[model samples]
Target: MKSTMLSMLVTLLLIYLSVCLVVFLLQRKLLYFPTPPLLHFSPPMEATKVSFENGGERLSGWVVNEGRAKALLYYGGNAENIEYNITFFKDNLPDYTIYLIAYRGYGDSTGEPTEAHLYSDALHIFDQVTAEHSQLSLLGRSLGSGVATYVATHREVDKLVLVTPFDSTANVARSVYWMFPVSLLITDKYESAKRAPNIVAKTTIIYAENDNVIPRESTERLIEAFSHRLENSILIRSADHNDISEFPEYAVRLKRALN
Candidate 1:
């Protein structure tokens, strides 16, 4: 009976290890959820479609209200159709030109999506736009917050805004799967908290009052990490993680933050 029990325990251990390996291998597949590209917009907002080569990969996005001295670079969420923001940008931020990048694999961009490539493409876009705009700001929401945080650490952004942001992808994953060794088994760990200290840009972090996606603790930890340069942190009352952008208070608070 003792030997049988020992064998059962060993079998369970092997099964657990196998599950961990599988999670490690396919972590990115679970993390990034790319939606189909929206090719057309109704009542078009007079934005121009643009494309550039980043490491030979064609990255595509929309550029709205070009020729403004002040500019905003927007990094969108996972599964987000970035083109949906065209009208919002046109109406709310008329003074600044906005560049909304569709992540590789999410839109017309031709490349697989990963943290390394996303950060690289962001840097490329930043460099390309810097010469044209005198003052450039950054806005990142959800998964894009990771990419945006990485860019803010490396580049010279005037203002940085993170919406529904997490302290780190690994931390969030670990919280979600406490029984598993997520930290050891995950790739593309967007450790935003680790990079927050180096960011010199005036920063604003926006959170939902009832965010069901990213845990409030993760967001609070990220806020604490930015104790040095965080200009403001706002929570949109009565908003959830996905619907926060639809609220009037969100835009109002965002505009205030940028100003």
Candidate 2:
């Protein structure tokens, strides 16, 4: 009987150690992700480097126009360099001045990426853009939606747009890992659904009908949170998470959102 009890105790210890290892691995992933180099592309807009308040980091982006115009600041997804988005911005709206922020650790920028640092970087970029241009229109896609939402709530802006956004990282965690307690584990809480309505600017929430990563249903929940404050909202048919800009409807909806 004593031997049997000893064997069971050993098995339980092994299982606990395995679970702890898994959690440790996931925590590291939650903190830092690899950022690939910016792909070379022909931008219809003029490219420039903007310095950040943080002495070490600088942002490289495309400036659409030199003249005074409505400024559009774009924040991109986790893995993408905002430089890749220049063609979409130039083709869709040439009249406006667009600043596509290439976040630190991505697109030829210096320094490692972290949740708090990135959020602070967004504010610094917004302050610079707002100083340069009077009318500021903020746009965010996927991971950027969290950054944009945070900015909109804190700062004054003319327009706000969120593309392929989820309700919150906590909810997304629940969906992806229902068996595990991810809310307690996740460090970066990109809670767009909870924060969007606090924004007083004219807002538009666009979701792709075919988005697999952030499902259409989650965006609907996001809309419900912002329904009272949002100026306009729409769903682009046949648009997937990564390829929403490929659809003509995206441009149309965005143009309308600007107005």
Candidate 3:
């Protein structure tokens, strides 16, 4: 009877360890759902294709209203098709040029996505394009919020908007994978809270009331990190993480912030 009990304990231990190993190895895979570019996704608007070399690889995206005096650089969600916003910006935001691009391994960009790579590429692209526009605003949604926060901290951003933002990827992962040691296992710990205090840009944050993907607590934590009062912190009623932007109030608030 003693031997059987010991054997059962050993088996359970091994199984738990095996599960942990799987979670560690596949963390990024579960986090990033990169959507491939559509070849025939030509919207009925005029947009200039922008391509540049970063670390010997080509990075590409679309620029609408290219010669405008101001620019808004948009960073989208994990599984977002950025081209979907082309017509909206072309019509609604005539005051500023819009820059929408995919991260590496997403859309038509080359290479793979990583926290380090995304941060590096965002800053590089911002520097390259800043010369063309007098002022630059940044808007990041979901996972892209981390990338946007990183840029705002490092660069001189005129305005910063974080939609469905989180305090840190580690904390968010811990909330989801509470059974495992997610903090130690997570590689891309986009620690926006740590960088928030450093950003002096006029900041606006909008979050969904029913964001199951990123808990309400996470967005609240991010809001707390900011030193000053946020220009606007509107909560979209009845909106979820994926569908927040679809709501009329979401666009209305965004237009007000940028304008």
Runs of candidate 1 exceeding 4 Å displacement: 39-45
lDDT per residue, candidate 1, 1-259, as tens digits? 9999999999999999999988888888999998877656553747998998899899988899989999999999988989889999898998899998788898889889998999999999999989999999999999989999999988889999999999999998988889898888888889999999999999999999999989999999999999968999999999999899999999998898888
* Tens-place lDDT digits, model 2, residues 65-169: 555568888888878767667667777777788887677787766776666777888888888768777798889888888888998888888999998888887
* Position 226, candidate 2: lDDT: 87
Estimated TM-score for each candidate: 0.97, 0.88, 0.96
RMSD of each: 1.1, 2.7, 1.3
Clashes of each: 0, 0, 0
Candidate 1, TM-score vs. the true structure? 0.97
Cα miss at 70, model 1 (Å)? 0.6
What ranking emerges by lDDT with the best candidate at the front? 1, 3, 2
Backbone clashes in candidate 2 total: 0
Off by over 4 Å in 3: 227-229
For residue 180, model 3's alpha carbon misses the true position, in angstroms, by 0.5
Clashing pairs in 3: none
Evaluate model 2: give its TM-score.
0.88
